[model samples]
Target: MKRYAIIVAGGKGERMSSNLPKQFIQLRGIPLLMHTIKVFYDYDSLIQLIIVLPANQISLWKKLCNEHNFTIPHEIVQGGETRFASVKNGLVAIKEKCIIAVHDGVRPLVNRQTLENCFSTAEHYGTAVPVYAIVDSLRKTENNTNFAVERNQYCIVQTPQVFQSSILKIAYNQTYEERFTDDATVVESLGIELNLVEGNRDNIKVTTPPDLKIAEVLLSEREAIIS
Candidate 1:
């Protein structure tokens, strides 16, 4: 089956308190986004990759790739104001009808097994999302005060969320709405049910400064063990 990945890396990294985009930040001496892309390449070297970068920073990405000696064949899509728009642009760049997986560029630790399962499920199902069951205590809040709810029904969703190319294309063709949190949410509006696959707990998306520190610790620990 033909498979492609759209790595969304357009955010300005304001929360990260860095002048550089968060995805361009280094983790274990590799760009965070590059590490995320490598996971899929490691799983299957042939899987196509399309990186959605901020329009203003596209040249920086190209320069970074050259500086790092990173090489993998992929297309570059300019990011939009919103994540959905960026993904839609990437989807438009794809020429074939196949399974396309949307992954957060900041999430560099998703394992091969999870990806294999997600693709395997997406082949039969029209849509698939990797999710980990919420293990923390249930909480409902109003005005920063906590209430209670059953935690059993909740799961923390992660990427790469896979979907049939045609289905995803149609989903993006719809009118833009702020309600669309993720691609799955947009596609589900078209009457598609999202199939859930088990996710790796370590597959965290680097958002805040603390997340980067955590990723560094994990990567360093892994490297020490390997060495």
Candidate 2:
């Protein structure tokens, strides 16, 4: 079966306090989005990659591609106003039946093992999302109040949310809601249970200056080991 990944990027860099969008920030010498796209290509060179970006940002992305001499093949589609609509637009771009992965553009550190876990699991079980065990204390907040909750009952969800393309397409056909946080949640609105897999601890979403520094260090270490 064919494999496809939809890399959704619509960040405006508000949290990072930068004028540039988070996806275009330099992780090493190149734009971080390039690294995110490369990992999927490294996983399977044959997998089709579809990038969803805002209409205004497409030219900037193209300029970056030329500047860095990046040559990985992928399709670019204009995103919608919200992430849900952006994913919907991405799904529209898929014309064939295959496995589909919805991933974060800022999360450039998802390793091949996790990709293997997600794609294969989704292939067998219909839906898969990566998650890490929460090691911090849990809390629940009510109106003007807060209380402790069971820490063991929760996990931090990450992407590369994989699904059979049919299942995903049907799920995305529903009306959008504020509760639809990620692809997992949007799919779960169909009452389908999500399959969870162990995500790499190092697959951090780069959103702040410190996160960029950390990713640079981690990626440098990996390159050293690989070389």
Candidate 3:
């Protein structure tokens, strides 16, 4: 079975307080997006990769890939304005009848075990998602109004969301509202059954300056132990 990884890296770093996209930000001297890709590569070399970047920033991505001596032969697709559109673009690049995993490029800490689990589970089930059960009390706030909710009912969604390539492509092809938060939501729209597995808490999606600091600390500790 052919496995594909779509790394969506097109978000502008508005919250990151940088002119460049958040995925392009440096973490421990290397681009954060590169670290995300390396996780997939390390997990399984046989997995094919499709990276989505902002249309105007494709040139910059190519240059970085070349300069960093990136050896993976992955395809690059032009990203859309929203995350859903960017993933849809990637779905189009893949051929039919395979396994495909969509991942946020800013999440560099997805462990190899998680990738393996997602892919393994997805092989049998049409859709598989990594999710963590919420452990904290939850409340909904809108315009400073707070509403209480049952924490037991919620789970925090994480990525490397895996599905059968054919099914996923068909799901993405269906038009929907901008409310599609993730690939699982798209699959849910098609009335498909989704399988869930445990996700590591360490698998974080970087979006702000504080996230960068946390990632730096993680990388430093890892390297110190390795050396």
Candidate 4:
């Protein structure tokens, strides 16, 4: 089946304490988004890559691509006010039947194996998302109160959430809602169960400065291993 990957990056870098958007921050001398695009390109050169960025940031991204001499082919879509809307915009570029994987542009560490597992599972199950078991103790807080909860009952959900285009398009067609935290939630609202596959813990979404440092270390280690 044909494959499509929609990479959503609308971060304003508020949490990262930077004026530049987090996705455009430098990682190992290249803009972070380029690394993300390369990962999907490596996974399947024929896979259609769509990057959804804020409308105002599109020109900056193109300039960065030219400055870095980044040549991997991808289509750019202007993002919306919300992640849901951004993803929906990215979906607009797809008009054919194929598998679709919605991913976070900041999560460049997602291994190829995880991508393969997600796309392969979604190819058969109609939906698939990667998840990693939580290692920290759990807590629940409400009304200015907090208490420990069972940690074993939950896991951290990661992206590259793959789904059949038919279901994804249908899920995105509904009006946006505050309760729709992620693509999986959007699909689940329609009573569609999502298949979860094991995800690599290193596939962390870069948000803060410390997160960027961690990504640099992880990327260096990966290069060391590869070389």
Residue pairs whose backbone atoms clash in candidate 3: none
Q: What local lDDT does model 3 show for residue 206? A: 96
Off by over 4 Å in 1: 142-146, 223-227
- Model 3 vs. true fold: TM: 0.93
Q: Residue 210, candidate 4: how far off, in angstroms?
A: 0.2
Question: Model 3, range 73-168, lDDT digits (tens) per residue?
Answer: 789999987888899989888876799999999999888778888999999877789988888889999997999899988888999999998789
The estimated TM-scores of all candidates read 0.95, 0.98, 0.93, 0.98
lDDT of the candidates, in the order given:
0.90, 0.95, 0.89, 0.96
Clashing pairs in 2: none
Candidate 1 local Cα displacement, residue 161, angstroms = 0.3
**All candidates: CA RMSD in angstroms?**
1.6, 0.9, 1.8, 1.0
Q: Over the stretch 134-217, how does candidate 4's per-residue lDDT look in tens digits?
A: 989988998999999888899999999999999999999999999998999999999999999988999999999999999999
Clashing pairs in 1: none
> Model 1, 175: alpha-carbon shift in Å?
0.6
* Order of candidate numbers by lDDT, starting with the best: 4, 2, 1, 3
Which digits, one per residue and each the tens of the lDDT, describe model 2 over residues 61-146?
99999999999999999999999999999999899999999999999999999999999999999999999999989889999999
